[model samples]
Structure formats: C-alpha cells, structure tokens
Target: MDYAGLDYRNIRFPVDRPLTESERAARYKQESYSNASPMDFLSVIKLNSNSIDLVDRWYPIKGFNTWFGICVVLVSMGALAGIYSALFFSNRTAPIETVDWIGVSALTPLFLLLTLGGWWLIRTECGRFTHYPMRLSRKTRQVHFFRQNGTVLTVPWDSLFLTLGESKSPLSGTTYDLRAHVLDDDDETVRDSFSLGYPSPLGNAESIDKFWAFLQPYMEAEDGVEKTWHHLKENTGYLVPVDNRREGWRWSIARSFMLGAHWPYLQLLFSPFLGLNALGRMLAMSTSKIPQWPADVERESQPEVNDPYVLTWRDNGSLGWWELYWPLICTVVGVGAFVGVIAWVVSGLWR
Candidate 1:
C-alpha cells in the first residue's frame, strides 16, 4: 500500500469499475476481530466525540528497516572490496588465483541480494512526508485526506469506494492495507486513491474488517463512543509516537524499543540494533514536514467545549514517565558496560 498515496506507479485493479467482492471482498461484513483494536497500532493523532485524525500509512517499523537496508548495502560493498584487494594485491607471482576466482563467484549472489534489498528499503522510505493525517468528522459526515502538496481532499463519508490494497513481492511476500478510492463524477472512474492505517499481514481480512468496524461506529453512531473501548478509556493520552508532537529524547528512544516482545532480557539482547533504529527514525522524521490542516477543515473539526469523549496525550493515564523511558535507560547502561570492557582490554595490552 502506498501510505503516502501520492505516487501512482502501478494500477493492478481496473480503475473504471467498483472493486468486486471477489477481487478484495469490498462488501465483507464489518465486525471486530481478535487483535483488531486501535491500540495495537500507533497511527492515531486525536480522537473526540466530534472527529478523529489518523496518520496515513504510519508504520513505526519502517524507520528501523530503512537504516537496516543502508547497513546491508555498505557491508556488502566492503566485503566485496576486501576480497578483491586480498586476491589481487598480495605479494605473489600470480596477481589472482583460480581459488580466489571461485571465492568471488560464490559470494556474488549474496552481495547482489544484500545491495539490492537494502537499496529497495531505502528507496521506499527516504524522502517522504513525515505524515499525512486523515480526519473523519461525525458531525459533518465528511472524510478529509491531507495530501503532500498541502491540499485537502474532502469527500462524503459514504461516497468513498473502499477496498483492500493487496500486493505481493518475493522479498516481503504478501501485505494488505485499507484503501479508499475517490471516484470522479458519474461514480464510475476512480480518479485517485489513498490508503488508511498501517499495513497488515497477508490474508488477514478479519483485521481489515474489524478496523473498518471501529471506524463505522465513530462516524455513524448517534451516541458517543463506546465506554468499554480501550483507546477511549485505558489510553495514556501521550500523543502518538509520531513527529506530529514534540516528543522528548527519552520517549523517542523508548518508543522504538517497544516493538515485539516485552521481556526485559529480550529487550537487552536487541538494544544495540534498536538504538540505531531509533536514530534512523529521528533522522527521517527531522527531514520530513509536519502536516497542517486547512483553516476550513480545522474550523469544521473543532470539538464541543464539553466534549466528554475527547482524548489527548495530555490526559494522565496508567503509564508514567519511568515506565515509558525504561528501554532507553537499559540501552544506555548496556553501552556503558560495553565501553568499559573495551577500556579494560586496552589497559591489559598496555601493561
């Protein structure tokens, strides 16, 4: 799925017709599925009785993967150069041997794989907008999509042609994302399209349906949001870990390590790579622009002064600063210990 949604490189489905039920199950009955809760993802910006804003295609893992790609490309090139130097520059009668040629040939495919894979990751992630927010207003019954060009596309909530964005690749396999198609007049031509939320695992239609089910009530319910909803109740009100808010250094570092398992030992094992991943995210976010809503959309989206369903990062919740920053603390201690070990080794050598 094109989370940024600006680039139209390929059009797999026919644009002139509505997506068939068989094509993507567009008419799939919307319902909540296990692990389909909004809290599982970190794309929401704000949620209130009046409206909700979400970061389009905001996947936290992408930042780490982008830096990983750079490392792959660099390491592959360095290995290739080292092999070439040792084979040709060694003081010998023959500059290169048959054994060296065989070694080089054996390593060629692995080198290409690393170089190409890394380049693909960097190409997809770098030089993109920090985020594009989409606002769904219950009061106005409109969906506002923020574009990279500082323009907002406003369309009625019910008018959008919704479908699943499914793509296959040899490297990453199959992935899915929720897509909303903007139809031209006469409702036959898909003029443009954009994705919502983050991508999901292959064939996880249940997740897609459940996510849509969550949005349906938010946009259509006559009453306020369900009190039982975790995001509406258990949320920490800390703005999402996106660049939209000015997060502190500790929070930024902590958020990156909050991936996958929660065990302390596992966290310690992965801290070094996680630290580099966090730096990559910070760099990417710094280079991109923060999206700003238009005056008209802003005015329309304002919540009631006494809005009871309003939720923001500022609202105090169960989590505290210590819990949020523990990952960064552990990472720092680990690095210090590593440095100490190196210093002790150097001292022994000098003695």
Candidate 2:
C-alpha cells in the first residue's frame, strides 16, 4: 500500500501471526542505544520541549530525476514525430514506403510507454502536499501522522510496535526505514503501519539505533527539555528547510546534488548535474502545496512562551560565499551544458 509518497514493500512481520525468530530479532527498543541521535532528523519541522513535528521522508532526488528523464523522453518523442512527418506527410519528400509504416508500428509501444510514464509521474507528483508531517507530542503521549488523503492517524506512543523495516528495489538495493505498526484490538494484528524517518543504506544500523535511543529519553524524561536533552537538541545538522517554503536556488543546487560535500573539488565534480537537478526539484516543489497540522494538533504541540528548546532551520546557520556563489556558477554552466547536449541530440534526430 502507498502511504504519502512511500510504497510499503517487503513487510516481513506478519500482521496476523506472532513474531518469528527473524522478525523478533529485527524488533528494537527505545532504550536500544542510549545517548544516540537521529540520523535523518532533516525532516524535523519544529522541535520544542513538549513535541517534535516532522515531515515525512521524501525522495527529492528520485522524484526530480524521474521528472527530468521524462522531459528528455518527451523531447525525443517530439523530434521523432517531426522526423516521421517530414518523411511521410510532406509532399516534397519521397513516397512513404510500407517499411515506414512497419517502423511506426514497431515504435508505437515505445511512444505509448513514454507518454504513460510522463502521465504517471505528473499524476503522482502534482497537486499534492510538499510533504506529510507527523507530530510526536510528549505531553499528550501520542503520535499524529498527516495522511496524504487529508486524514490523521493518531495512536498512543507506547502502543506503537516500532521495528526495523527492509525494502528492496532494483535501482536502490535493500534499504531500511524505521516503521511503527499499530496493533488492532487483538494486539497482534497490525492495524496499520507507517515509516518515521528516511531510509538508510545497509550497514547503517548503528546510526538508526542511536537515533531511536535519543528519541526515547526526549519523550520519557521528566525534567525540562533543556535540563535533560540540551546536547541532543543542538544536533540539528541535517535540518534542511525545503518543505515549508520555496527553497533558494543555491540551496536547491546544494541539496539536490552533492549533499554534505563541502570540498570544492567534490562540488565541481557534481556541478554538471546540479543545475538540472535544482531545476527539477524547484519544479516539483512549485507544484506541491505546503502541509499544515490540524488545529487540535497545533494546540497540543505549541510550545510554552519563551521556551528555550524550540528549534528551526535558522539554527543551521547561513551559507558561506563559496557555498552560495559556486552553486550559482555551476548551475549556469550545467544548464548551458544540458541545453547544448539536448540541442545536439535533437539535431542528429532531425537529420
């Protein structure tokens, strides 16, 4: 089933049966790794003493790249149609042969496939919220997830069956996402399931474990958020502000390609693809609406006046000259390169 933008795949834990040996092994506790911090808290929207609001994990790169590929395919298809028109429909051209019809017949499926792909991408990516956010309210002892269909799923925090989830795709190998299963009245059947953070690559279990460890105390601790979890609160390095508003061009380029790569050489290495990726991401974001929490959720999650633990993207700090200028320069060069390459391809197809 598809929830938000993610497809639930390879759900190993049986919804109806008791946990098997392997499934039991995958189950982990909040106390699994003490003093651990979240690996993908980039989704964190608002963090305060009582609650933490987070956007659902989104695959910006994948969505942007897929849309880009579709654009190129559409352009190529247009060029092919033009070529066919010149050969068969123009009076100045030689008589169309039976072989030409056969060629068009053979290519029909490919054209249809490309059209279907473009349609599907547009259908999925457009007219949706930029993200689905979830709120973890320590005071309420409940979790509220914003569903894509405009419904909210509320469950008690302690009752959630938090476990390691594995999903495999040919493009991306076995990746892990932290998921919570909501049990039915029987307490064994999984009433529903949803992922918490972004998926991680294999061998990153330690980081995920620590993230879980960090969250447990943040909720369970009786002291003020500052007194008990000040250090953990400061760890908002992964927080990138792309969800609530239109991201700046430099940020789009920086976030779309070569994330966390500070070295100039690495930036230059990824520069060529950065421009188009930024454009793609921008296009996707423009079409999507920003998500908002329900009124009741807003009421519960609101922080106390003058609360010190409240955190936002501003805490991540401003970008440097090189960080800003280099991406802008690279984006210009990359867009020029992309145009040149597409021009060459279209010209060759025309001939």
Evaluated with lDDT, which candidate comes out highest?
2
C-alpha-based local distance difference test score of model 2: 0.64
Model 1 ranges off by over 4 Å: 1-18, 28-40, 80-120, 148-151, 164-174, 185-189, 199-203, 225-231, 235-238, 241-243, 246-248, 261-275, 316-326, 329-351
- How many residue pairs of model 2 clash at the backbone? 0
Q: Please, what is the TM-score per model?
A: 0.69, 0.83
Candidate 1 residue-wise lDDT at 257: 69
Tell how far residue 191 is off in model 1, in angstroms: 3.6
lDDT (10s digit) by residue, model 2, range 131-215: 6778889889899988766679899988888877665555456556677888777776775777776533322556557556646
Model 1 per-residue lDDT tens digits across residues 75-111: 7886777676667765658657678788899997889
Model 1 root-mean-square deviation: 6.0
lDDT (0 to 1) per candidate? 0.62, 0.64
The candidate scoring highest on TM-score is: 2
Global Cα RMSD, each model: 6.0, 3.9
